[model samples]
Target: MKKSPIETVLGILVILVAVSFVHYAATKIDVRPQDGYTVSAVFLKSGGLESGADVRISGIKVGSVTGLKLTDDYAADITMTIRDNVKLPKDTTASVASDGLMGGKFLLLEPGRAKEKLNDGDKITKTKDFKSLEDMIGDVIFLATDSGDK
Candidate 1:
């Protein structure tokens, strides 16, 4: 079978459209990670908090966790990258939070009222350590049993 000139042109148009659609899709789906300043915070326990986790403020995403390591004091040191526009106060607090009871972990940043802004490579002084579910459960059970014995 022989293809007509109109059919050949239509096939070429379809291929061009397909390629354009693919390029557009690729651009839309490609999320380039933000390049920003790094700040460290130490936590007693990370509670499964890992790198690439979201760093949110007021429930809005403003940054992300970039690195995690152990400190000499046996604590977890978390490095976060905050956007250039978001200037954090020196007294800002970093806490590990979960979306829900069984949800994934994220870093929650609570802004402080201090006049001094945190600079690049500065350490966040106020950090809330991550509390595990097992620890909370144990505490609850202890409280209930103790009350019952009374």
Candidate 2:
């Protein structure tokens, strides 16, 4: 087929526009972790928590899970990289929580009201294990059956 000059120019323009759009989207949606400081927390279990999971405070993302390790005490040691701007207290608590019933897992950071601030590489001594939906449901059922029997 014979193509005119206008057709060729329009095709080239479309290709250029597509490339520009991809570049723009890539830059805007980059999920690479930014410069941050690291802190460690130990949980009884990872509970499906993986590296790159969100580490949030008050439902807002302030950091991310950078690594996971098993400690000699049989606990899940999680390494979190938090933004340098966010300072946490020494007594802060870290808990593994789900987004909802049967939703994804994330680290929930509950900052403590204390005079001491946590330093980089410091360990978070307090942590709550993740409670699964089945556990809660079983407890509810057990309570209901026991009450009915009584």
Candidate 3:
């Protein structure tokens, strides 16, 4: 027996919807890179930090931010997954920096000279937030006037 045309179209629609759902689920899941370890940092201000933001070392992409949260002390907590082979020293600093005047934000890692290496769950102590252009201009103007008075 041959199936009706309407029934055949309905079956196709159902299959298409199922496939679309699977695709959506796959994309929503966070698939971390294989050779990486997760680390976190607390910042006073994240300043446009979002999940999937690039984490860089010496202007080179090393990892991406995976998560962000607010701590009890009212600070922003950012979680990043860095490659395992890229060992960071104990005194390393993690700061929030921007790419350029109109570019996106990223995490900058500055390695220190400490002998010990950072382990998982270690928090980077030194952090710098994005400074607004207006603030910088204001500071420059203030400095110029103040220096002239002196």
Candidate 4:
């Protein structure tokens, strides 16, 4: 069978479009951590958190989640890279949070006013555990049913 010139042109056009789309997608996903220092925090629940998630402070992204692991005590050990200029205090707290009910997860930082500063590799001691919607519903149901138990 002999192929037409138009068919050959269409095939090359499709390949070019696919390559361009792949390059666009690759550029949009900026997951590589910027130049920064790393610190860790332990959370009882990861709450669907994933690596490359944004780390935000007061609604502004200042870092990113670099690693996630399971600790010896069965907790979620999260490592994050924070911007060099954003120095956190020893009393700063980290929490796994979501943007909204239908949105993705992020690590929220609440910096505390301490004279001392946290150094690289220091583990944050204060952290708020992630609470899922099911947990909140269970708590409500328990209170509603246990009102007369005691």
Scored by lDDT, the top model is: 4
lDDT of each: 0.92, 0.91, 0.86, 0.93
- Winner by lDDT between candidate 4 and candidate 1: 4
Put down candidate 1 lDDT per residue, 43-147, tens digits, no spaces: 998999989999999998889899999999899999999999999999999999999898999999999999999999999989888888888999999888785
- Where does model 2 exceed 4 Å of error? 2-28, 148-150
Candidate 3, overall lDDT?
0.86
Clashes of each: 0, 0, 0, 0
Ranking by TM-score: 2, 4, 1, 3
Clashing pairs in 3: none
lDDT of 2: 0.91
The local lDDT score (0 to 100) that residue 42 gets in candidate 2 is 90
Full-model lDDT, candidate 1 = 0.92
Error of 4 at 148 (Å): 6.0
| Stretches of model 1 off by over 4 angstroms after superposition | 1-30, 148-150
Lowest lDDT 10-mer window, candidate 4? 28-37
- Expressed as tens digits, the lDDT of each residue in 79-149 for candidate 3 is 99888889888888888888788999899999999999888878887777667677789999988888564
* Higher-scoring candidate on TM-score, 1 or 2: 2
Candidate 4 lDDT for residue 4: 100
Number of clashing residue pairs, candidate 1: 0
Q: In model 4, which residue pairs have backbone atoms overlapping below 3 Å?
A: none
Ranking of models by lDDT: 4, 1, 2, 3
Top candidate, metric TM-score: 2
